[model samples]
Target: MLSGRLVKWMLLLSEYTITYELAKAVKGQAVVNFLAAHPVPDNETISDDFPYEQVMMIEPLNLWQMYFDGASKISGTGARVIFITPQGDLLPYSFTLVIGVYDHTPNYTRSPEEYPSAANSGRLLKGKVAIITGGARGIGAATAKLFALNGAHVIIADILDDLGPTLADSIDGRYIHCDVGRESDVESAVNLALAWRGQLDIMFSNAGVAGPFGSITNLDMDKMKDLLDVNICGMVHGIKHAARAMIRGKRGSIICTSSSAAIMGGLASHAYSLSKEAVLGLARSTACELGVHGIRVNCISPHGVPSEMLVTAYRNFFGKADMGPEEVGRIVGETGSLLRGRSASMEDVAQAALFLASDDAGFITAHNLIVDGGFTSAFSTMSFIYQ
Candidate 1:
């Protein structure tokens, strides 16, 4: 019964009404202003004190080249990385960045030109002799590689007979099978290093385990004793022999690996935390006594590095054996990290060891370098603001 002319008129009237009402509503809404394209220089806040204008003096993207960078949604204020690629260039693509997130510039382009003909020409621990405990894996292994690359004659001491010898051969260093928990074994390892190189300049004691994770109500006393033997007695044995050699030379650097669990509870089981704290106390007391002989003793407390032992713990807890280190690091970083940018790596702990061993830390001694990236620095109150 409806006419074609009437249907067309109704459709046109409905369209007009919607358009008018939408326009009116849009006009009545409040206007929003956006920030400037560039960052404003503010000296009042520490984070904003950088001279952004000077640092951002970058060339515009050119033909066959592009640069893209942005802020992360979580932190909202971190480093911006850029990549530039040339057309038809696959193998020789060069990367250059003006600034990094840590306020250091990327030396990718300049490194090659600045390097000498030899790789280990200008090394930090050149011509030094170093001994690293647990050098077959984890932080100790990384530090051994670093020390060898830096021109140090390294000795990899570990109970892992196969891996220890293999790593030693690869790095052109020597290996000795000696359990650190046994005083005699530790002494033999130190003596072997001394006999080979005639002196010991650096000793890195970095071996630990997270004892059986269980409630205190059902504590395993035997396992707890074993944990103390390896974590606490191990360091005592290392220091006993290492200090003897260092005292003969009247100069040395002795480093130990502790844990952030030492300072902050609940990060690890009771035995692990207690043993790590004992390491700090041992370092302090040893430093006092060793200072008279020109010997330096220090410790590094790293947080949540997913080594083999840590991975085993993770797998056992979650019933997932295939979980990777990156995933565990991501989870730990989310909870403990104050920077919220990157997770703790084995290399981070190794680098701390390197600093303590090198001449750069000559005046530093008896200090416990807590390398948790500010985790212990903040309390529960800080979670409300950053988390």
Candidate 2:
């Protein structure tokens, strides 16, 4: 039983709220402001930093067509169209902002006849040789399989010699026994790869251990040292050997697997978090020293990937007798910001590693690509509820 004027005002307020939320979702405030200040002119070529502009015309329908068609031509120039409503609502669309690199670049567009297939995707890594440590199971195994499927000659190195050979046979990769914590083992693994493939294009130093789970006050120093040796020391040895081989070749990619525990405190045991933090630091130092040799070093900080290690640690920490992998995954999903309401899969981490090792990410180095389902950004202490 509201008045007509009150209903109208409420409707207008609801529209504004929806617009604000949409803007927050896509992070489009800067783009909207940029468009507002530089209105588009009819039939006039407007050259801007990002190569797209918003046109305001008296004729909405005709201007929409003109904008769409004109934007199509700019797309050939690598620019894209973004639509904004009169009510300050922005429509969602995929767009590329062409900068200085588009000056003389060829305007190539894919037709239906030239579309990609699984066979073409497999060719993306043709002739490339990749070495993956701890490649027997979990993320390492997934990465090895993906690299093989993408046509890279893969070498699986792990202390678990039994599983390593089995996994290699399944993935069409070679196997080598490598206890990454030992410098000699790492050196031998590199030698094996060089002897077999005659070249190594990528090195994935992913061998790590979670160690014993307990309260920091009651934690065993010996257990902590063991974890550090395998996790941190292992990475050091891997980097040393990988760097030597990569330096000799004068070009390569080195990827280390860090964890989301490195970024946020209190997410894991003290030793585990320290080990991951050290891994991130190692990536930065390696990138600095090896950039001269055209070697790219990067790290992936993955969150909530289902693994036997995670399952055991959670069960031990909470003293839950019957907790399983699915329950652990559910707990992580609740803690994370997945809009789809699911935990991150091993394939997600594998894909991130693949990109870092691929030539597509050539210019990217010394960065931690966090694939955490928005955990780090979604919550802040200064929010109203927290305050």
Candidate 3:
């Protein structure tokens, strides 16, 4: 019976193999006919998701903007350049681009630090009060501005005294100095939020560190512990006090920042992964505990967001302390996503936080909204080194 079953399986495989080849041929022919009928449009309105893209052209290189830092140019040290590919993907010149045709010189333009948004009016979280940890810059600052733009009263909470107050002032929001690693700071921030608005509508625990980025074998327990304290305990503190403040209102949204490292190993440093994974566990635990109080607890796990945190991580990883943020950004953005032509940005992650904070995600809880552009799901078959 086993032999018979094997024979049957072999027959099935033979039929499938034949069918697969036939299907491929038919699909190829169809794509050829379709493209033959269609004319290639210009840059202003060209679509990339076309069929039979086994062959590509130079239009891609034409779109990219090359930039070298002013300091590097003055130093005359070979003049390194970062390529902003397709208005989104930042790819370093050294990085391989398998465009099926290919290839760059130099063209400096506006940085991709600016992002377009879907929420224009201050209506999504209108009248809602929010505490955004790490709101001084990067994803946190972007979320704060987006939140304020969408009508939420944003409190920029961070240890960055210089930038935090400025960001809050720009948005007409308040700024609170919070280390996040300290429960007291978190509690105080929550209290301040409640004191200002009489209720806490949202708590976005977005602050995190890269944390001693190198081999797991070469690690310091003390440094690891500190990373965990900031990444895990910080999230816990936010959930705790936010829950306390939220229970009063009987409805609040709590958003925690995890990393792609938590979901996929070697995507980040050992200490960072340990910290972020703990964040997920804490997020799950707090979500279950706080759900009873009508609070939605969720995590946004971004993959290689081009922030100062990641910049430092890459600097450590590549052993290039002299590497600037632009180069770091290009390096990350290149490998960030499985979605071709699209790279996850600070604004993208911020928008996700905003969604979780708003009434839109009222029913979403105990959820991990992975902002990886399907990377963790699809990025497979690596030897899995300790990042």
Candidate 4:
């Protein structure tokens, strides 16, 4: 008999977990204190059916003390939580939770002295409307923010309605819950975006998955198919519909999220690499055919952008221990390139997309920008270095 407030807290916590796995980082004592802070209804009794002993054994006071002590350390650091049920099955309670003190700055606070204001920076996309899939976080969120800051009305499409709206609110953009893998949902999202801004100028087909990272010899066929449906077919659907809309409007830009793995072999699992290669082909062919209609089709093959998909892949395929996401990113940055010696960040990829989206790159069509810090080139020179 969970109280309504307890249920609400659990649900919120669960939602947080879905977006990240740090919720699992909350120790037993922290859970108890959190529960105590938002106590259950007076007459309600908690269920004894689950693993109560493991939970009750936590030291509440110690946990609260640790949380406060570590508040600054964890602030703005996205941590995900994963929960397992007594039945030995994985639960869907993965979410990113930020642990930190609150800052209540006024909305009209002056821009930091270091940054330039809109008045000083020329607007590259003054009257354009852009749609970004999976725009709630990671690369998608960064792209949305970049577009809005550059004077474009952005439509943030993501399945995480909460994060999407929060991100949009921060950028003065609009959010729509869209699973881009679903055709109907995508259609609705496009319609919604057009209704808000009267026309669509850029469509970023960036949502994708690495799928379950395992050798082909032992991988699940069903999982492989699911990955293809979302990674490959999803991009295809986005291209098809985006092209149709752009043809009607007589001008547009379509950018897909291909990967550096697409241009080379052995970097990722079989399906992920294959899907990205397919995306490249799709972008090239669409660019050729859609060129007549004034729509530019391009792909950005970025390397190691600290995305959730890449984090999962590192843990799964590399058999790496749970070094924090940042640590994983640092390792990728070191190993990904010889020239820059850093993995491409979300900002790097967004900048590439921004250039392609803007009129500055108007002549750039059917182009595949390898934003991989010379990864492809470095790999080719590996034998020379050894010699």
lDDT of 4 by residue, 276-371 (tens): 999999999989999999999999998876788778667765687674578667887677776545677898898898889998788899889999
Best by TM-score: 1
The Cα error of candidate 4 at residue 7, in Å, is 53
Tens digit of lDDT per residue, candidate 3, span 1-387?
A: 121111011111222232342234333221211001111112222233322222222111221222232212111011111223444432211111111111222122323222011111124686799999999999999999878756688998999999999889877789999999999999999989888988899999988877675576889888888887888888888999999888988999999999889999878778888888888888888888888989999999998677887777677768888887677656655666666546678988988998898877889998999998788887533526635
Instruction: Go through the candidates in order and give each one's C-alpha lDDT.
Output: 0.69, 0.69, 0.68, 0.68
Local lDDT at 284 for model 2: 100
Candidate 4 matches the true fold with a TM-score of 0.66
Against the true structure, what is every candidate's RMSD?
19.8, 16.1, 19.8, 15.5
- lDDT of the structure predicted as candidate 2: 0.69
- Total backbone collisions, model 1: 0
TM-score: the better of candidates 1 and 3: 1
Kindly state the number of residue pairs that clash in model 4. 17
Error of 1 at 155 (Å): 0.6
Q: Model 4, stretches more than 4 Å misplaced? A: 1-121, 317-321, 380-387
